[model samples]
Target: MKTIIGNDGARPVNSTKILSPVPPASTLTIDHVSIKIVCQYGKLQMAKISRSSDTAHVTYLTPEGLKEARAELEFLKNEKRAQVADRIQKARELGDVTENAEYDAALDEQTLIENRIIYLEDVLRSAKVISHPSGSDFVVIGSTVKVEMDGEVDEFTIVGKMEANPGKKRISNESPVGQALLGAKFGDVVEVSTPIVRYKVKVLQIK
Candidate 1:
């Protein structure tokens, strides 16, 4: 028996097996069987048998983003890890660890650093670097787009989710505006819809 859990409720099936060729971002377990499901940008795709421990997913990154992640991972694994270890050792020398606030704080910081190191390692392992767009004929992952909406002109670069910073005019390709602008050409108008509002923007340039 296989069961699917969703917003509506749980639905069960008999004499059926679920399988997904590619692993997704999330998993669901039913009847001791693990199924992979992809949930991104408010969309969901379910099906694929795998162990719950298998949590690898493709991380999209630009060339610079990939370099930054690599640098961070290197620093964490080499310098930061040793620094935390030294702190823990120094704290341990300061009497009973059970009652030592410095020891506890160092341990906490060590945990955080280790967790980040693991995350960055995983990201690096599963990264897919976005290639530079050719000619900017149409919007792509690395395109810097100029747009006009509500009589105001704005510019932003479309990057992977990991490098997205709205404050810096860098938006994720998965975002509503980026999705709408993708495949649009210069002087083309596109509709951007979000839960909060729906509006139109005209593509003024693509770089």
Candidate 2:
């Protein structure tokens, strides 16, 4: 198997120098990666990348994404509220609230529902939505790359966390294949290693 050495930008760069694969095998280090969230049209998107800092950055959704999140949260909250109200009314008709099993159960349900609503709201507030950059060239997001390996051809799209799925070959930018192909040009050879197998991949097309 062939090994592709990483370049650290010095002239005739240290070809002999190799970085020991970190344990836990993260595909890419999100050093100084910035995250943002936004919503557009009706779809929500999340974006992330390694920035020029010592930490990782990630971004997600647009205004549209936030709207969708809010809608779902509202639905859940309202449904729970109605259920609790009905339970309380029924318990009141049974006479004593202090001894009513239905009243206690209804209160417990309300408490759980409220907790879930708060949890969802917190997650939405912290989510970073990806904003599609105009003229985003070089496989930033939503770009499909076609590759060839040992005469076998395959295609993959590098996408956000929500869209990443291996079953459809829609890989995350943080995956082995995706990381190996980032910034690569057509006809260039790349090496990718996973727990099961290693790949000698060639770029046939980038779109």
Candidate 3:
């Protein structure tokens, strides 16, 4: 999921490869074998873009997104944990461990709950809390932007992938349209292209 942008052009590097030479098996007892890896690349070059002072300011997530995330974490900590513990205890009481469907289901539930708790914890830690700033007319990460397309006006808020709900007009900053609108000012026309279509829209307001 690494992204590299440069003046030359962007190209995705897949898994890099390394070759290892085999040693004689007779030289040592082959109880087990392991190898360490190292990588070196020669003189990498890149052109950097100058940052514009007026480039769009982004606020990562809205208060609502933060609240929802908190609620989810609470559910995972309280309700989900309790439910899984109860399932495990009930399964244990059923006896015959090897043939127990309930025990297997309980274990599966435990695995899922633990994984989700880890994910939620990470999300809460990394999430940027967003608030609507006073008197700011420019679009920022969490500011809801109004855009005009052929006389039709639509509003959407820019958000990170975790908080974006496109159906609700909350777009991920990584998305094409979102990227195009990143630094746009009112009355500025920005063109966005996707694999399926192209759109020409004007920035109207940042609320």
lDDT of each: 0.80, 0.62, 0.68
| Root-mean-square deviation (CA) per prediction | 15.1, 22.8, 18.1
Please provide, for model 1 over 1-207, each residue's C-alpha lDDT reduced to its tens digit, 9 standing for 90 to 100: 888889999999653234334433876787655655553223232234543336646778999999999999899898998998899899989996645788778767776776677667767778899987768789998899999999999999999888999999999989999899989999999999999999999999899
Query: How close to the true structure is residue 145 of candidate 2, measured as C-alpha lDDT?
Result: 79
Best by TM-score: 1
- Ranked by lDDT, top first: 1, 3, 2
Candidate 1 local Cα displacement, residue 126, angstroms: 1.7
The regions of model 1 sitting more than 4 angstroms off are 1-56
| Candidate 3 displacement at residue 120 in angstroms | 1.6
| Residue 195 lDDT, candidate 2, scale 0-100 | 88
- In each prediction, how many residue pairs overlap at the backbone (N, C-alpha, C within less than 3 A)? 2, 27, 2
What TM-score fits each model?
0.69, 0.45, 0.61
Clashes of 3: 2
